[model samples]
Target chain A: MDLAVEVENLTKRFGDFVAVNEVSFSVAEGEVFGFLGPNGSGKSTTIRILCGLLSPSSGHARVAGLDVWRDAERIRQRIGYMPQFFSLYDDLTVAENIEFYAGLYQVPPALALARQSELAEVLELGPVLDRLARTLSTGWRQRLALATSILHRPPLLFLDEPTSGVDPLTRRLFWEVIGDLAHEGITVFVTTHVMDEAEHCTRLAMMHYGRLIAEGTPEEMRTEHVQTMVEVQAHPIWPVLQALEKAPEVVEVALFGDAVHAELRCDLNDAEARVERKLQTAGVAYERVVAVTPSMEDVFVSLARRWERPTAAGADR
Target chain B: MGEPAVSAQGLTKCFGAVCACQGIDLTVAPGEIVGLVGPDGAGKTTAFRMLCGILPPDHGTARVAGYDVVTQSEAVKARIGYLPQRFSLHRDLTIDENIQYVAELYTVPRDEWQSRREELLEMTYLAPFRRRLAGRLSGGMRQKLALVCALVHRPEVLFLDEPTTGVDPVSRRDFWKLLHDLPRQGVTMVISTPYMDEAARCNRLAFMYAGQVLATDTPDNLRRQLPGELMQVRCRPQREAREALKRCSAVRSVEVFGDRLHVLFHGTADPMLCERLLADAGVECLEQQPVEPSLEDVFMSLVSEHGLTATATGNGL
Candidate 1:
């Protein structure tokens, strides 16, 4: 498979603090690869390394099949990066901002203009082209930034939390644009904490404490990590949660919306009966308790909990 | 709801020609967590400011903790804890000192400071890091400190604006747990978030779009508004399956979810219809099942029904 991004034992350190600790992953061509982690999980660091903005302390990385360290400048031309913070010139109009990035990327004048018009149409930025970038809403600004990033038509794009604060509608629309780009053979490497957005990616790598904890398709992650998930809808959920916390068969429990999602070590039937007996003994009334598919969020929570227990016990030792 | 802890009637706000919020009505029963959810420029922040007495509504009235927000702004402010998008904790100060400063700003009684400080720290799991500089804490830890500072006075109501947007999953979960614990103590909270999952966690949700409240209901009730049964289809060559399904007369909408496609039927379309369509198109259908509509599906349907463009508009600018 032609890889758009490849990392081998990648690590970054600032003095004693390890940011990206031996992280390794690869993205196939035309793939929508999602890098998911909590804040301070070294996602930004890894992206920066791939973008040639930062150097890794050890290991090797390649973007667009060029060595990140040796071909840093070449990699810059082959990849487009959209940082978490909007980096466009706020004082410039939308058209001017796109033109500026186009010039910086050294696109021919005629080609730049043509690509600008194409992007404006695809991103629906035509109406806002003459408006100052500063006056645009977060959603519009993000769309403009996205347009600017892709003006050079790089084969690979790195978007760091591009839809972080936008509304659901804008997010969906943005993903649609991304999907279109991927269909056109542009590899998209995006980072996000939102599980739903992560689910949109063709593959996902979940980071925690500067390490890649899990990586796979969302369905695979859920099935492999979580055996049986029981969703309990009950009034006054707190008491039920406390009761289930002590149950030996319950591996992990977390709130999912108004319901309590409990991952059980036992099969669905045994777990349901055990949970029912406990809820009844505790005098808690439930609307429903049924086995359900674990969402990506549930899988992450379960993995994080399991990861923490051993470390927490080690701390006691 | 008996004598809502927070109530607004025809509350409106405009920024020059932009109507950030228009005739918005809201109510939150005591001890309930109501989420104000929408996209950027949906006026969630503007509505929050009006209710918290930071920005006066241009029209109508709002009351927080029995005090009119416009007429008795100070009283309203005193009874509520407001955590804006930017909370402005003294980054140079230690977590302990930041709490002390906020307590002083809120004029918390000197006699109650020590115990209240300890309690808030313990509640947020910041007790061990009390001596750490606020700037040095991780994104989640910093938010926890901010939460602790916000609760220094133990206000009856809390207004949090996108409090967990960029935090990691573990931290986000921890933060939600903190918020979940508050309702039991008779603290009413109105939190604004762009996340559907977080919105689902609320006791009630107000879906805002284009400065208007589209709907307000519990998660289950809101989901019931989705017009038809959602069928989860696992098929090979997803793009082909999606296109084939879209051409089918019975399909209302086809959404891509990872490797699978969620097809919403118009009315009660038979599952066999989809199977037949895919088979005719030569797309392999591995599995199919009727599934529940997620909050995202419900929100997407609602937004599209309202003729709101998921794409950005320059009208506000």
Candidate 2:
């Protein structure tokens, strides 16, 4: 199998602080790989290192079959990158921005014009092609940025929270382009805090602080990290959660909207009985209690909670 | 649930030729959390700004905490805490100093400063980081500091605009937990967010699109408006299966959820029809089962019903 990205113990440090600590992962050619983490979790740092904008403090990574450090220049030419912030010239018109980027990447002028039209159609930027970048809305600007980034038709792309503050409609539209790119064999390595977007990737690596806590297909991660969840629909969910916190059969309890999802240590039937008895004893009225599949958010919260508890305990020791 | 903490009728705002918000009507009962949810450019911010008295509406009237937003703008401002989309605090100041500064701005009594400061810090788990410069705090900690500053005056109503957009999942969860605590203290919250999952946490939600309110209901009730049964299908060569399923008359839509496709069909449609379609397309079916609709599903259905295609336009792959 061909690999688009290969990393081994990739680490980055800023003086005494470790931004990314010995992380390892790989992305196959044509795969949509998602790197998910909260802000300041070293996700950006990792992406920077891979994009050849920042060198790793230690370890190695190969992007598009070229070493990120040793062959940094070559790798840069082989990959497209869209940063978290708008990096294009705001003073330029949409067409001018696309042309400028195409020239910078050394696309022949004739081919550049053709590519420009192609991208405008694909990104639905035809109506705004002559609009000043500064005057465009966030959605249109993002589409323009994406079009410019891929103007050279690189084999891999790095989208750093491309939809962070974008409207849902625009986000879906952007993902449509991303999906199309992946179909045409362009590897996509995207980072986002939005769990739903992660569901679009072929596989995911979840980062917290500077460490990777989980990595797998969403289903695998759900099964491995969050084995079972019992959803309890009850009014005053906070109090019910408080009561369940001390229950021996409950592993963890979290607020799921108006309901509570409790991870149970016992079998489903026994756990249901235990929960019923406990809630009854506390006089906490519940509308329903049933076992349910864990959502991606549930898995994330459970893993984060579990991860934090051990670290806190170790700190105490 | 006495009088509404906030009520707005026909609230409208226009920027040049673009209508940012149009005839929006909203009400929030005292002590309730109401989420204004929509895609970007959906007028969530415009409506929020109007109700918060930051921007005067182009037409209509609004009252926040029994104070007319237009005629009694000062009173409305005095009774509410507003956190904008961006972090808007003095980054050079320490967390404690920022809180102190906001307290001073709100004219918080000198006698109440120390205890209120300590209480907010403790509640947000930022007590230990009080002396840390806001600039140096993590994204999560900075948000917590921002929240503390917003709550410094103990306002009756709170307006948070996309407060968790870029924060990590752990911090986002932590922030929601803090917001969940406010209603019990009689502080009503009007939060605008682009995230559907966060919308689920609100006591009520208003789904907005193209500067108009599409639907307003509890998350559960909105989900029930899907008008069909959702079938989750796990199949190989998913792109092909999805395309094939879309051609079936029984299927209303097919949404990609991670590696699977969620096919929404009329309740009277036969599930076996989907299997036959996939088989004809030579896609191997791994698992198929009925599943409940999530808030996202509801949002997608509503948006599609309003004329936007529910699925993003792309080559099936």
Candidate 3:
């Protein structure tokens, strides 16, 4: 299979602090790959390496079939990156920013105009094309940034939380462009704090404290990391929460939208039944205790919790 | 429930030609957490400013903490705390010093704030790092310190503007635990958030779009109000299937949720209709199942019917 990004034993260190530590991952062409973790988890370091912005202290990485170390300049030109904010020149008009990127990427004058109009139509930037970038609101600003970055039609796109502060409708519209771009064979490497947005990725990998702790299809990650996740409906939630927290069979439990989600121990064959038995003995009547499909956030949280146990003593220090 | 901590009617604000808030109506009973949710430029922040006594509304009236927002702005401000998004406290100051500065600005007595500061720090688990510089703390810790400062005055009502927009999932959940505790202390909260999952955490929600509220209800009631049942359609090469599903007359709206297409139908979900549509388009269907509509789903469909789904021309968050 063709690959868009390949990394092996990649590591980066800033003096005594190791940011990206022995990480390995691969992204197939046209896949929407999700890289998620907390802010200081070093996902950013790995992304910088993959984008050819930072050299690894050890190991290797290749982008668009070019070695990141030897072909860093070429790799930089081959990928599109939508940064955290309005990275465009604030004084430049929407159209001017697009033009600047077109020239910077050295797109042929003839092809640039066609690609500009194509992306304009896709991202709905035509009406605001004349407006200065600084004057645009959150939704329009994000769209313009995304449009300008991909003007060269690179093979890979790196979107850093594209819809972080955007509304639902605008986020949907933004993802529509991302969804279509993936189908057009442009690999998308995205990082987002929004769990549902993470759900759309073709595959997801989680980083924590400079290590890749979990990687798989969302479904696989959910089942493998989150054991016997269930949503329980009960009255007077506070006492019920306290009751479940003390139960040995339950690993973690928290309130979730008028209900409580509990993760039960996997060693026991009947995890759900164990929760039911515990609740019954505690005289905590529940309306239902149905197993739930753990969300991407749940999987990530569960992974983070499990990763924390082994290093709880000295990792943070 | 006692008198509402916040009440508004026909509140409106405009910045030149742009109508930041058309007419917003909302209420928050004492001890309840009410969320003003919408897309960026939907006026969540504008509405928030008006209620917090920072910006005067162009029309209508609002009462915050039992004080008229227009005539008694100062009194209203005194009774409430507003935590703006990315709140930048003096980064050079220690956590305790930052809290002291805010307390001084609010004119909180030293003796009053001394005990309050200790309580807030203890509640948020920031007591151990009270001497840490704001710049040295991590993102999550910084937010908690900000919260401690916001609560230093012991206000009756709190206004939080997108508090967890960029926080990682695990930390976000931890922050929610802190928020959930505030209500028990009789601190009513009005928060604006772009995240759908976070909306579910509120006691009530007002869905906003284009400077107007579309609907307000509990998350459960909001889901039940979706025009039709939700169908999760999984298919290989999702772009074609997504387009095919969108084109189908029976589907009210189609949203890409990770690897699956969440199809909201006009009435009952027609499985065979969807199958035929994908087949005619040469797309392979992996699985089709009935799934519950999330807060995002409900909000998207709520706005799609307004025909504002593709329009990025809204006011401001």
Model-by-model lDDT, in order?
Answer: 0.85, 0.83, 0.84
TM-score of chain B of 3: 0.96
> What 10-residue stretch in candidate 2 chain A is worst by lDDT?
A308-317
lDDT score for residue A134 of model 2: 75
lDDT of 2 by residue, A1-317 (tens): 79999999999999999999999999999999989876667888999999998999999999999998798888889999999886878888889999999999999999999999999888878867776777766666778889988999999999999888776677877877888899899999999877777778888998876889899987787778866688898766777877887888787776777788889877765767778888999888888888888877778777766766354331110
DockQ of each: 0.53, 0.40, 0.56
Order the candidate numbers by DockQ, best to worst: 3, 1, 2
Cα lDDT for residue A16, candidate 2: 97
lDDT of 1 by residue, B73-188 (tens): 99998899988887787889998999999889889888798799988877776776789888878777888888888788889999999998777676787788778889888899
How accurate locally is residue B28 in candidate 3, as Cα lDDT from 0 to 100? 89
Candidate 1, pairs of clashing residues: A38-B168, A167-B39
Model 1, A32-62: lDDT tens digits are 9999876767889999999998989999999
DockQ of 2: 0.40
Clash count (model 3, backbone only): 7
lDDT of 1 at B162: 92
